[model samples]
Target: MAKVSISLDAELVVEVMVLAGVGSPQDAIEAVVRDYIARGHRTEARTELKDEALRELDAKPQEPQG
Candidate 1:
């Protein structure tokens, strides 16, 4: 594992620790980081799909309505 140093609000850190029922700051930090990374991946995938749909739309010609 890698060691990273990040500064967070003291109150926010305490809240996360209490909610997670974790004794150490590291455990709370790890849980938050993991959730953030997972959500990021999901967002990226959605963005890519949206872009692809836009491209397909742009490639299609509009049809005239009677």
Candidate 2:
């Protein structure tokens, strides 16, 4: 694993700790980043599913009712 050193706002770090429910800065940051990536993946999956559904709908044959 690569180690990085950067400055962040103190309040932001504290908030991350609270929101992420983690003890240390590293854990908090990692949790938040993982959550963000997971959410993005879920959003992409949903979009793909919707597009697939639309394509399937378009491909289906239509029936005429009497």
Candidate 3:
């Protein structure tokens, strides 16, 4: 993967490192970003499934009750 350089506050980096249980700043930030992306993908898939189910339900005809 290509590498890029960016500056961040020391305190914030340390906080991420601790929360991520990573020894290095780079690892901590990368882990957090990867997790964030994975969560977004999962949410999208769930929403799509829900929308499909709703569309299917709307397309079906309802039966009359006596």
Candidate 4:
């Protein structure tokens, strides 16, 4: 995998380390990025499902009632 450098606030780094249970800020960031990427797939799947539902609704004919 490729590597990149990022600058984060000191407090935010500390928070990430604690939340991720990682030794360093870099490890915490890596864990967060991996989790985000994995969760993003689920998010896209949900969006597609919602769009399909909207499309189905649009395609349905309206009923006339008195």
Every model's TM-score: 0.70, 0.79, 0.86, 0.68
The order of the candidates by lDDT, greatest first, is 3, 1, 2, 4
Which candidate number maximizes lDDT?
3
* Candidates' C-alpha lDDT: 0.93, 0.92, 0.98, 0.92
Instruction: State how far residue 24 of model 2 sits from its true place (Å).
Output: 0.5
Give a tens-digit lDDT track for model 1, residues 26-47.
8998898889999999999999
Candidates in descending TM-score order = 3, 2, 1, 4
Higher-lDDT candidate of 3 and 4? 3
What is the Cα-based TM-score of model 1?
0.70
Q: What does the lDDT come to for candidate 3?
A: 0.98
* lDDT of candidate 2 over 1-64, digit per residue (tens): 8887878898999999998888999889888888999999999999999999999999999898
Clash total of candidate 1: 0
Per-prediction CA RMSD (Å): 2.5, 2.5, 2.1, 2.2
Lowest lDDT 10-mer window, candidate 2? Answer: 1-10
User: How many steric overlaps does candidate 4 have?
Assistant: 0
Kindly report which residue pairs in candidate 3 clash with one another. none
Runs of candidate 4 with Cα error greater than 4 angstroms are 63-66
